[model samples]
Target: MATNSTVSLSMKFDRTSILGSGGYGVVFRGEWNNKIVAVKRIEKTNCENNKGEDALQKLHHPNVVKLYHVDSDIDFRYYALELCQLSLNQLFNGDEAQKNYQEKMPPEKEVCLQLAKGLAYIHEKGFIYWDIKPQNVFISVHPTDVENVSMKWADFGLGSPLNDRGSFSTTEHNTRPDNWLAPEILQMKENFNRTTPLRQEGTVKSDVFSAGLIFGFYLLKGRHPYGSQFNIPANIVNNTPVNLKAIEEKKHPMHAIIMDMLKKNPNDRISAADVITRIANIQ
Candidate 1:
């Protein structure tokens, strides 16, 4: 019978190659106990005073990446995780094989359904997945069927637990990437007032906005809903509406649902549960 394995300095694995790198740390493909796995190496300084490790340890959904083990030395922390074949970003913009595979991508409804299920589980567990871009969504082959693939949410480093009011502060990370930010968050930054409570800067709706952007990008073939303007961030900050006419003409069935998720007013945006229901209906 096959069983899960763990790794450590004493039980070391060979780092075959680097999978990717970002502000957080580097991910590498590794071989452990004769099985391939992903090894994430994060500097101790980068992970200090953060709840990411705790968050990943507690998360156990099929639609979320599985953490096999964690080990650390004086300088760095390492996470042994299930190896995913590709990220949604890679499928859209990676090498020739990855690009070619996009043509065979799952339907948008199915993709969103998986994402919404993951988000629902996260929200139910009292964490807000602040990051929901394509790069954070991974594609993996089914354990029993080599021909089947599924999407799993990855990279929970930026996730935060909901506060007393079911919201989280975005003040500490002021320079977050603007492309995926919700309008309210941008507005809060623009109209910064010391008297205003920092916790009000973000809510569950902010995540919905980011997820909507991912769906729109997928439907539009990697283009931002606002098109390729140099001032895209500024436009997003100002709550410039995304024109959905093109997607509607393309007969993308989720156009209405995407627009609902992208509402300028956080109060107007649809909840992750609602998104799941809507997508399930379509499917």
Candidate 2:
């Protein structure tokens, strides 16, 4: 069990600091039992998982951060998780370091190698990490003398159950962060009505497709081959499928491997082994 200094109801955990935030919830650095911990609390009136406490308990991995315990929304409750100092987002986005990420890019081949290792680990267990954005990956729960470029998949809030095709469940989030989402996620756009049933079911290939996108981001200076923040590039919107369109237009030699992974047809997206094999060649 991880540490949790109890914070009473009607008492807001002293928000010493804020970690990172996303659509699911915001994270804060708090003190409990006189010790530091990360408190993540999600509020959804119809949220079946509430604070995701149960799902957090089931995931145990060396690279994945540990969840101490949860303080449910039973009474304006908050979840208490292991409080780590920084996320890849912070390390890469902070003032002193922001320039580093902006100017000096890390070896794309090396980072892809590391991701391959993590992806392989999760896939072997029949699990698909539906979300694999840089924000969801973290390093060093605590530091050691030696330098280790180790990273673990941290957020399982969107974890998918393998071998359970017959089962389906509905959780909120009628909308998601579209930047990192794969093409299929927008499956029901053809329907003008928002209430129409949209198939958001995740598949292993979807994970692979997302991996290709991340690889594209890394190799292309954080550029989403599909065109992102600035505009969804002209070439991408013309005829080619959104996911593979930008990748296809690139004349870069290395992009060939990445293009294959970005295939719009999820069934054609590269597998975990294919990613490992192709990514290993970048060096």
Candidate 3:
């Protein structure tokens, strides 16, 4: 198990150190044992269904964020985690790092493989990372090799366990960005309003869809496979075809795997593990 030093040590944080904030909590940059760390302060009420802390405690992987400690007070729960340099969203879209990311873009196969490995590990542990967007994907630069950077999956607040039927159901429609969500999720939300029976439940494959889009966005240099921001949700729901011509022209090996992952039907999508397998020979 990872160390839990929060109880024995006194750590301080404030709003000024916030790195990001979401519906669940705000993450602050702080120091622990002379090492920089991220402290997530989430209100207790908002964490009733959050599986992030518990899941992080059990999941230790190169591609998964490390949890250093957990602490709680009368009103909020605090999590001490490894501090990453920047999020995928910041690296890809932020003004400060845009030029840097473009100049030193990590090899496509390596990044895709690492991300798929993380998702596969989560699935192997019987959990689904319901949110797999650029914001939740973090990047860390190598201490010795600047050219060698690593990526990891973070923020598991929206995650859930896969039941005996290999799926889970939720009524929360506003938990994720519609453009980044799986088609089945959007369909369920639409059906719920009409009191129609759900045809498909959330599953690991749904996560695959989101992950596929992220990988495509990264490989395509910020172009979404599903068209523009306003059109993504509709395109996904309508099963609109994706245009990967830029990558296809370059003969990118992961192109086919990404296509399989973005299939509208959850059943048609490839498993995270299979994604790793398909890319194993890339290098």
Cα lDDT listed for each candidate: 0.77, 0.57, 0.80
Q: After superposition, how far is residue 13 of candidate 2 from its true place, in Å?
A: 5.0
| Candidate 3 local lDDT, residue 143 | 67
Better of 1 and 2 by lDDT: 1
Candidate 2's C-alpha runs over 4 A off are 1-13, 31-36, 44-47, 50-55, 73-77, 82-94, 98-106, 139-142, 166-171, 192-197, 230-254, 281-283
Q: Point out where model 1 deviates above 4 Å.
A: 1-16, 32-34, 191-200, 241-243
What does candidate 3's lDDT look like per residue over 1-283, in tens digits?
1333443445555557778998788898876667678888888887776577767888889999988877777777888788888888887677766437655557778888889999999999998888778889998777678887788999747667788899976654355677888998888677564344444468999999999988988887777878887888888899874657677788888888888998988898999999999989775
Instruction: Give candidate 1's TM-score.
Output: 0.88
- Listed in order, each prediction's TM-score against the native is 0.88, 0.72, 0.89
Q: Which residue pairs clash in candidate 2? A: 5-32, 5-33
Candidate 1 lDDT over residue span 218-261, tens digit each: 77877777556566667676666455568988877799899899
Instruction: Give the Cα-based TM-score of candidate 2 against the true structure.
Output: 0.72
lDDT of 2 by residue, 1-283 (tens): 2223444442235454567677767677765556666677565442445324444566566655667665654523466666654555545555674435333323556666666666766666666676667677665523463234455566636655465762223334455555566666545333334555455666777677677666666565545656655444233323133444454566544477666766777677777778778777664
Which residue segments of model 3 deviate by more than 4 Å? 1-9, 194-200
Give candidate 3's error at residue 242 in angstroms.
3.7
Q: Which candidate is the best by TM-score?
A: 3
